[model samples]
Target: MKLPESQVAALNAASATDETPIDRLAEEAGLKPETATQAVFELRDEGLLEVTERESVEYELTDEGAEYVESGLPEVRLYRTAVEAGTDDAPAQMGRIIGASGLEGPEIDIALANFGRKGYGDIDSGELSADPDADADDDPEAAALAALAEGGAVDDVDADVLDQLVSRNLLDRHERVVRTITLTDAGVTALMEGIETAETVDRLTPEMLTSGEWQDVEFTEYNVEADAPEVRGGKTHVLRQTAERVKDVLVGMGFQEMEGPHADADFWINDCLFMPQDHPARTHWDRFALDVPPIEHLPEDLVDRVESAHREGVGEDGDGYHSPWSEDFARAVALRGHTTSLSMRYLSGTEVGELEPPQRYFSVEKVYRNDTLDATHLLEFFQIEGWVMAENLSVRDLMGTFVEFYEQFGITDIQFKPHYNPYTEPSFELFGKHPTTGELIEIGNSGMFRDEVLEPLGVEHDVMAWGLALERLAMLTTGAEDIRDLHGTLADLDFLRGAEVTY
Candidate 1:
């Protein structure tokens, strides 16, 4: 079920021929190729396969494999011998395709005996047969293919041999594809004898569509559609939709929308916030810095204050903090690491002077980090960064904001543990129990700006800065197991189209 709707749509091999290989079964089953293949092995594992390894490389499982595959539990395999010979206890049609040509049993024996006793030249099974001796070894592969072809799909390679033949005059092992194809639930059903589709009927339309009751009915007309239910879907782009919903939640709570350029200098980013020049985060490796005409000036007053602070502890301790300010560092351009950088920028920009009681602002945008990408991490991602400027915006005010944001997501169990961030004093990381998996997942970080960081910027009252990771929020809201789901390219339109969300 963790499989996204896009993945479900791509699993098409379920409708393929039974003889098709597992690698190519994806399309028919309406699943990814890998999903189909995995489904095949699953069927076999569950004691549902009647595998017939007709060829050395490929094995064919009977209809049981196909049945199990379609049932969605393809991981079960019930393997049986490829073929069986006739015996006293054996059935009349053991391993035989027909009465005798493919059947191997006592019935074949009786037919062969009746003919052989009449001085028949040859006998096979229970039939008077002209035994054709074939030297398949003359062309081992060709013979195998011919035999496999006549036997009807050796487990999964249903494609024509000519395709492989066209590849070359000289057979290269590397060029060869050695893989097994198994029938999915649909494929097995299709290959089964007497398997007939329902009589074509006019698609039953809902009265709502015809009555013009729903003008927003934007669904495309489908001439034909399989009844098979795909992982249910249709929604806004998962990330963007979730972003909008989250935006609404904050905005509804009186948060003004804020925006900033993707690129910013250290002055607005980290410098004005009192990030030490020698801090590792300000290093070139940590930030995506720009080199064009390096060095931009900070606000003259702010610059003087910052410079004076470096010259002498500008705030609480104007002693040890007195160090040299790096204009170059301030000038250095880089992609914003945290949206908190933007919050800083917004605060430094032309202001509303004071909170005037209470003022809130927020933004949902991309942030860049020079870090290794993994299931839980990415190089670039969106962040929902915001802050509330209030006359009495204390640590409690920030916590209230957290509660308000999560409540909109229908989340109630919040873990507000004290943590630390470079820019915010008395910082804390907010964690919420994941709805699906009760695991504690960190959603965002929040705290009050330190006076050392604020005083240099000017006219600043208490402004709380909280930079939220969008991926984490999505993981919390959608119960997505992987953070990459937010940025997945294979994602289908329905993956995020009409999701249940709240403001």
Candidate 2:
């Protein structure tokens, strides 16, 4: 009997009576697991061995779960604190109970959220009450975490409790296909007959070629049907690929790309957009402000015009907000919340000189915000900012532009709702039905630039502008249910690698 070196090694390691896992077989064979797997498949094809596959599940504690095991679960800590403060008899001030719990920041939220669900306590009207009968010592989730930390059998833990912990991100569950190999009757017979190793070269070597022995050497048979390890070579991320595609689409639509500072003065970000200086969106809570010196270089004439527009009015029928406006506030530096700042620069002749009518400009740029992370929202994301300057631009033109742009990405069922913006008149919030969830998700905001916004930049023509979420569009195109799945700490590598951005 004859076999390849790897196959002979694998066949010898495999047992006829006992099913051996591929890992142990590979170790005994002294071969790479992938190589062993290939050899096993080849042996199976020849009816010399049998292979079986089964799903194996594994659970690992997240960083948060480990922390809870060292300390205690947040809800457990809160309940114990409440009981210590005599809340088991009557409700106590929620703040006092939480303060004594020693839980701070996100931990406080975690405690309050789980405290009620776990039957640990009741919270109502800023008060907390611990259930005396509720046993924190027997908490299934906490017990599961402890059991996992101590390397206990997973079968001893409740499946439902494990699922709950996974939902809470305290545990990560992994599933894999584990293959087992066993020798067949033919394989036993071949071993009894004493199989000999065949000298098969996988690749021709320089020594063999120089010795003129390459022609006489036997080449290994190629098994195209064998399973190979996944090769994830370097490639552009789906998000980046979509962004570049967007750039190509915009450029094809006769729009020039715009570029500017990511960290810039509030003048172009909000002030020049006719946003009130005291508007809630300008506060530090909503924006990422820098602690550097105020921007020193600002167009003096453009600043005067914008200030006049804010203090007085744009035209005869225009009315400015009766809010106090300041140059110092406009000079304050912050990360641009939107790329409209670039539009302001171009419109004000501060970038690429003055522009004429019938001009289109666009930018695909990153913006910063103080937003809570969730399935749909991130702290930083790309914004598809664009505007068209032409004569007598109307709502119809704005709607038509969106229809044309979205059609490029195969999104035709766009919906628009009346919305309000500080800079655009007749503003609309654009939406598209999610491909996976069938929910209408907001994709962008658009409208004609108002007189108050345009007059400050000394623009006489009508301009339609928009600030669209690139991530949201990607979600629609890629059928991604969660924006986090597209890009973030929780991004799914498999989904990204397989997600196709169809034009």
For this target, which candidate reaches the highest lDDT against the unseen true structure? Answer: 2
Candidate 1: Cα lDDT at 192: 56
Over the stretch 1-503, how does candidate 2's per-residue lDDT look in tens digits? Answer: 88899999999999999999998999999999988888999899999999999999999999989999999988899999999999999999777888999999878766776787788878765578999999999999999999999988789887889877876778898877889999999999999989999988889889998999998978877779876666668778888988999999999999999999999999999999999999988985578899999998998988998998888878897678889999998999999999999999998888888889889999999999765445677778999999999998899999999999999999999999999998998999999999888999999999999889887788999999999999998999899998867875446666887888878
Candidate 1 residue 256 Cα shift, in angstroms, is 0.9
Badly placed stretches (over 4 Å) of model 1 are 1-235, 295-297, 320-324, 351-357, 489-503
TM-score of each: 0.54, 0.78
Give the lDDT of residue 82 in candidate 1: 11
| lDDT on C-alpha atoms for all candidate structures | 0.55, 0.89
List runs of model 2 lying over 4 Å from the truth: 1-9, 26-35, 59-147, 156-176, 189-220, 372-374
Candidate 2 residue 139 Cα shift, in angstroms, is 8.8
Model 1, 443-463: lDDT tens per residue? 788889877677776636888
